[model samples]
Target chain A: MSEDLRERFPEAEWIDSHDQDVVRIAPDQLLEFGNVVHEAGFEVLADVTAVDWYRTRTPRFDVVVNLLSMQHRRRLRILVGVPDGDPVVPSLVPIWPGANFGEREVYDMFGITFDGHPDLTRILMPDDWEGYPLRKDFEVGAVPVQFKASHQVN
Target chain B: MTDKTIDDPEIEEVDLWVSGTEEAEWDVYSTDEGAQKMRLEETGARLTEQLGSVVTDDYDLDDIITEDERMIINMGPQHPSTHGVLRLQLELEGEMIRRSKCVIGYLHTGMEKTAETLTFLQGPTNVTRMDYLAPLHNELCFSLAVERLLDIEVPPRAEVIRILMTELNRIASHLVAMATNGMDIGALSIMTYGFREREQILAFFEKTTGLRLNHNYIRPGGVAADLPPGWRADVSDICDTITGRLTDYEDMLKENPIWVGRTRGVGVITAEECRAYGITGPTLRSAGVPWDLRKAFPYSGIENYEFEVPVGEHGDVYDRYRVRIEEIIQSVGIVRQAADAMPKGDFRIDDRKVTPPPRHRIDESMEALIHHFKIFTEGFRVPAGETYVAIESPRGELGCYLVADGTGKPWRMHTRAPSFYNLQALPIMMADSVVADTIATIASLDPVMGDVDR
Candidate 1:
C-alpha cells in the first residue's frame, strides 16, 4: 500500500518513521492523496492533530492524519506541511465526515484552517480566545490566577 | 385608580359559520371617536383583503409552520443530565428534536499543550487526568507511545501486569458507564448494583497501586511499582465477586421489561453511521463491528489473552448496554488468566537511566547515589522520532501521538481521546429523536467531558 501510494503520487515523500508508514505530501496535494488512500481501503480517520515546529522547520505546522483501515487492519499516517504564511489545508470532510470535529480541534488548538469544512468554528476553545494555545510561540501562563477569599463561619 | 369589572358580553343564539365572501368580517359599529376609528377600520380592511380568508380558509398544515415555529433550546453547560458541562443547542418542533449541535470546551484545560511542557517521565502524570474514568488506559497509551519512540521493550512481567491492570480498569470503567447509564434512563436500582461492584474493583486497584482513579502505575519503561503482596488474591476475590454481581445485573436489567422498553430501540445508530462518526469501543461493537484494538492491534501482550470480543446485532441503546455487560464478563476472564500466568521478574526495566537505583544501594554506594542524582536531576533523553500508539480504551480508541526532539521533554504530545470522537456521534444519534430521549442518548454515548474537552 505504501508502494502504491508512492507510485500513485511520486511528488509526495514517504517516510517509514519508527515502523509506522508516514507519507509527507505537499499541502496542495493533501486532498488528492487523501482520495487515493481513502480508495485504498483506509476508511477510518483515527486521529487528526498538528505539530508546530514554528521557526525550527520551514513549514510552521505538520497536520498529521492517522488513517486506519478496519478491513485491512493497518494504519497509515499522512503528514501535510502547511507553511507559515498560508497555514491552510483542504478539508477531508467531503471524504470522511469524522474529520469534522478533529479538524476543528486542530484549528482550535493550532490556528491551522481546514478550508472546505462546512462549519470550522472554534472547538475546545472560547470563540474570543486570544491566540492558538498549542502553538510553540504562544506564551503560556499569560492568564493570571485569581482566588477569591473564602467565607466560613468559625 | 378604582378597580372595576368590565361588562361581560352575553352569548345569544348565533350561527357557527358566516358566509361573508370567504373573508374575515368585523362589525363597523364602535364607541371610539375620530381618527382611531378610521385607523382601526383601515387596518382591518387591509388585513382581510391580503389574508383573503381567516376562519373558513382551506390551507395546508405545513404552510403555517415557519422557521420561527421550530424552537431552539439550550440544554446545558449546566444541566445535570448532560453528564458534564456540555451545552447542547437543540432545535425542537413541539416535542420532537429537529436538529442538535453539541457545544463543548467548558472543561478544556489545554492538557495537550501542558504535555509539551512536561518531560517524558511526567507525561503520563498529565495525561492520566484527561480521561478520568479510565486513567490507567490514558497513562498506558502515553507510556506505550514513549516506549516506542525510545525504542525499548518492557519486561515480560511488566507487560502481563499492564494487561492485568488495564483489563481491570476496563471493567471498572464499564461499571461506571452502566451505573450512570442506568440512573440516566430511570433504572435507578442498577446504579446501586453497578457502583457496589465498582467500589470492590477500585479497592483492589488501591491495594495494588495506592490510588483509586488516577493510578499512574504504567510508566514508559515499565510500571511505576511492583505489585504488592497478595495482589493476586485480591484480584481473584474481586473477579469472583464481579462474576457473581454481573449475573445479578443481568437478572435486574436483561430480563426486566422496563429496562428493555427504555433502551431496546432508543438512540439507534447504524453500523455505517458509527463508522462515519469514528465511534468505537462498545458502541461500535453494539453496531456489530468486531474491530477491538485489543483483538486487532494486540498491544501490551493483549494477543495472549483468551477472550471473546462481544458484539451486538442492533446498534441501539440496549445493545450498547448488553455489549458493555458482556465485556465486563470477558474482562473478568482475562483478569483471571493474567493472575494464573503472572510471571516473576523485575517489574521495571533494569536500565540505570530509566529506572532509578535501589534505595539500599543508594544508601550504601556513592556510584549509586551519583547515578540516582543524575537521573532525577535530568531525566534521560529519547532519540528523535514520532509515533502514534493506540489501545482499546474503555470508551474507544485511546491513541497517543508523541514526537520527541532528542530532549527530556516531548516536542509535541497529543492524545486522540475516544470521548471526543464518541461525543461527535451524539448529534447523529439524537437526530429526529424525541427531546426527552436526549438524556438516554447522552448517557449511552458515555463521554467523559475531561476526555472531550482535553
Candidate 2:
C-alpha cells in the first residue's frame, strides 16, 4: 500500500523503519507528508514524533513522522536527523501548523530545537530553566553538592 | 532557596546593583518594571574574567537594553500562562515590554540524572514520567534511542502497535494543550471538552497498557504486550467519538471574535528570527516554515502510512488552534488506518537480550527461568558506543543520547528537550506584545512543565 502511494505521488521517497515494518521518510520531505497525496485524498496528520539514538556515531536524535490520509485512505512517514551539539531540525509549523506545540515540547523535554519555529521559549519550565530531562543521560537534579551541608536548615 | 542558617534566603536578584566602588553591594530586589537588567554592570566586567561564560562569544552587554526608564515586572515561578513554573522577569514601559529575562529551575525534577544510573532498557520507563501528558511519545523517543545504539530491529507487530498507541496518545496530548490554552483565555468550557475527550483516550490506554499516564509499555526492541482483545473496536470507538467532540471545541474557540482578537495579532515573530534562534513546531509553523519531522524521518511503521501536514497563515494563537483542531481529525484517520492495516507477528523481538522468556517457558525450561531472573536483576549488556535518536513528539523534537561502556548500566545519557530550546525564543515573541497577549502566546505554544523541567 505504501509503495502504491509513493508511486502515485512521485514526489516522495520510501524510508525503511528498521525492521519495525513501516516505511519512513526524511525531514526535507516533511512538507509533502500528507498534502502531496491530497489529490489522492489523505487529510489526516496521525502523528508527528521522534526517536533518540543514544549510541549513534554522532550521538544525535532522529525525528520521525507517522501520517494518515483519511481522504485517500493511506499512510506516510518521515525522518529528521539532528546533531548532538545542536539537535535542531526545521520546525514543521508552516506545513502542519499543529506541530507547533508538539515540536516545542520536543525542544523542552529533549533540548533538541525545532529551527525556524517562532516563540521558542519554555512552555513547561521557567524560561531560564537548564537541562533537557528526556535525554538518556540528562541529570535529574542539580549535580550533588560536593561539600557537607554548610549549616543547618530550619 | 538553599539550606542556610537563620538568615533570610537571599534571592539572587537581577540587574539592580548600582556598583558601590568599595562595597560588593546589590539591591537584591527585582527592578521596578520592564528594565533589562544585564549581568555585566551588576556583576561588573571584572567578574566575567573571574567567573562567567568560559566560552564567551561577544555577548555585548552594551547591546543589551539601553533604555533606563523601563520598569520591571516579574511574571512567574508563580504567574499565570507560564504553563508550569516558568518565571519571566520582564522589563516593561507600562504595557509594552522592553526587555525580558527568564528565570527557571524552580520545578526541576532531575529525571535525566536518574536515567544515567539505571539500566539501558529501563530508561524509557522513566522518561515517560517527564512529559506526563504525552507519555507514550516520550517512551517511543527514548526506546528508539537505545535501540539505535544496540542496532536492533523490533518485531513488525511490535512496531505497528507502538505507532498506534503513540498516535492515540498524541491526540490526547494535543487535547491537553487545547484545554489549557482555552483555560488561560477564561474559556472554561473548552477545557472541560478537551479533558473530556482526553479522558476517553486515557481509558483506552488503560485497557491496553494497564496505566493511564506514565505507561512503561513501549520498551526497547518492542512493546510490553500484544494489543488486548477488542483493542481495535475500542480505539475505533474513541476515534469516532472524538471526531464529533472536536467540532464542538472548534465552535467554542475557532474564529470566535474574542479568541481571534486575543490570539490572531498577538505575539508575532517572523520566520528569520525564528531560524536564528533555533525554533521549531507549531510556533515555527505560525511563522511560515513548513518543516515537520514525520515527513522528514519516518520511523516505526510511519512511512507505510499517509497523512497531512496542516500549515497556518500567521504564526499566532488562532492559526495554532486551527492547525491542532485539524490535526485531531488527522489523528483519527491515522488510528483508523492502523486498525485497518495492522500487520500480524510477534510483538517483541526473538532476542532474549531485550526481553525475558515467556512465563510459560520459565516453568519447564531452566534456561528460560534463569534468563528471566538475570534480566530482571542485571539487565542486558549493550555494545560499547554512543548514539542519539530524536522523535517528533507532540511538543516538537524529543531526543535521547546514551553512552555505554559495554555494561548494562549507561555510562552517560542526555536528553535534547525541545521545550528548553523553544522557551528561549519566548522573549522575542512576548517582548513587544502586551501582557494580555503574553497569555495567548504561551497558550499557543502549549508547553508542559514536566517535560520542560524534567
Candidate 3:
C-alpha cells in the first residue's frame, strides 16, 4: 500500500515509523491527499491531532491525521508540517464529517486552525480559554500545596 | 399579555409528524433579553444548524410549523438519564426534536496534557481513568502503543491473560450499558439485576488488579501480574452464572412489548451515517456493518479465539440492545477459550530494562535492587517515533496515539476516545424523534462521561 501511495504521489515523502506508513506532506496537499485516500476506501478518519515541536524542529508542528480503510483493514497516518507562524491546515471535514470534533480538539489544544471547518470552536476546553494547553511552550501550571501544620523539612 | 383560555378557537391542534426540513430558524423576539441569553440563543441556533444538516435534507417546514412554536431547550449536564455530564440542546417543534446539539467538556481534566509529564511506565495509570467503566481497555491501548514504539513483545502467557481480562471487561461494560438503558426507560429492576451480575466480574478484577475502577494493571512490558490462583474456576463460574442470568434478562426485556415499542423504531441511524460519523463497536454493528476491530484488525492474539460478531438489521435502539446482549455471550465464549489455552510461562517480557526483577529477587540480589529502583524512578527510554494503536473497547474503537522522543517521558500522548466519537452520532439519532426518546437514544450509545470529556 505504501508503494502504491508512493508511486501515485512522488512529491510526498513517506516514512515507515515502527512498520507503520507515515506520509509527510505540505499543508497545501492535505485536502487532495485526503480525497485520494477517501476515494480509495479509507472511509474512517480515526483521529486528527497535532504535535508542537517547540525549538526542536524547523516546521514547528506536525498535524497528524489517522485514516482507516474498513474495506481493506488498513491504517495510514498522514502528517502535515505547519510553520510556527501559520499553523493552519485545510480541514478534512469536507471529506469526512467525523473529522469535525477531532479537528476542533486539535484547534483547542494546539492552537492550529482548520481553514474550512464548519464550526471551528473549542470542543473540550472552555470558550474563554487563554492559550493552547497541548503546545510544548504551554506551562504545566502546577500549583503548590500548603499543608495545615507541617512545614517543609530541609 | 392577553388572557388566553384553554378554549381559545385560534389555537391549532398540533399533530406529531416527521418534518423533512433541513434548516430551521431561531429568531428570538424579546425586547428585554440579556446578553447572556442572546449569546446562548445564538450558540443554540448555530449548533442546531450544524447538527441538523447532517441527517436531514433541505426542505421547507414553515408552512406546517411556525417559528414561534419552535423552542430551544436544554436537557442535561444534570439529568439522570444522560449517563454522565452530557448536555443536549434540542430544537423542538411541539415535542418532536427538529434539531439537536451535544454540549460537553464539563469533566475535562486535561489528561492528554498531563500524559506528557508521565513516563511510559506511568502512562497506563493516567489513561486508565479516561473510560472508567472499561479502564483495562484504556490501559491496554496505551500499553500496545508504547510496546509498538519499543518494538518488544510480551510472553504468550501475558497475551492470553490480556485477552481473558479484556473479554471479561467487555461483558461487565455491556452489563452496565444494559442496566442504565433499562433504568432510563423506567425499568428500574434491571438496573439492580445488571449491577448485581456485574459485581461478580468486578470481584474477579479486584482479586487480580487490586482496584475495581482504575486498574493500571496492564502496563507496557506486560500486565502488572499474572493471573491469580484459581482464576480458571472463577472465570468459569462467572461465565456460567452470567450465562444463566442472561436468559433472565432476555425473558424480561427481549420480548417485552413495552421494551420493543420504546426502542424498536427510536434513534434510527443507517450504516452510511455511521461510517460518515466514524461510529464503531456495537453501535456500528447494530447498523449491520460487522466492523469489529478485534476481528478486522486483530490485536493481542484475539484472532486466535473463535467467536461470532453479532450484527443487527435496523440501526435503532433495540438493535443496539440486542447486539450488546449477544456480544456478552460471545465474549464469554472468547474468555472460556482464552482460559483453556492459557500458556504457562513468564507473565511479563524478559527484558530487564522494561520489566523489573521479581520482588524476591530484588530483596536477595544487589543488582536486582538497583535495577528495580532505577526502573521505577527514571523508567526506560523508548526510541523516538510515533505510533497509534487501537483496540475494541465496549464503547467503540479505543485508540492511543503515542509520540516518544528518546526520553523517559512521552513527547505527546493522545487518545482517540470511542465515547467522544460516538457522541457525535447523538444528534443524528435524536433528530425527528420525540423528547422522551432522547433518553433511550443516549442510553443506547452507552457513553461514559470520563471518556467523552477526556
Best by DockQ: 3
Against the hidden true structure, what lDDT does model 1 obtain? 0.83
lDDT (CA) for every model shown? 0.83, 0.68, 0.88
Which candidate number would show the highest TM-score if scored against the true structure?
3
Q: Over the stretch B1-454, how does candidate 3's per-residue lDDT look in tens digits?
A: 9987879998787876664442356333222221112133334334544344554443233427666888888888899999889888787888787777787888999999999999999999999999999999999999999999999998999999999999999999999999999999999889999999999999999999998889999999899988899998999999999999998999899999999999998888888878887898899999999889999889999989999999999999999999999999999999999989999999999999899999999888999999999999999999998999999999999999899999999999999999999988887888777899999999999999999888
In candidate 1, position B3 carries an lDDT of 50
Evaluate residue B411 in candidate 1 and report its C-alpha lDDT on the 0 to 100 scale.
94
Which candidate, 1 or 3, would have the higher lDDT against the true structure? 3
Q: Which predicted model would earn the best lDDT?
A: 3
lDDT of 3 at A12: 99
Stretches of candidate 3 off by over 4 Å are A1-4, A142-154, B1-51, B55-64
B372-448 per-residue lDDT for model 2 (tens digits): 98997889998875555667777776766565778897766656666765665666666555777778777788777
Work out the TM-score per prediction: 0.88, 0.69, 0.90
DockQ of predicted candidate 1: 0.36
Superposed model 2: Cα runs more than 4 Å off: A1-154, B1-69
Scoring each candidate complex against the real one, what DockQ results? 0.36, 0.07, 0.44
Ten-residue region with minimum lDDT total, candidate 3 chain A: A142-151
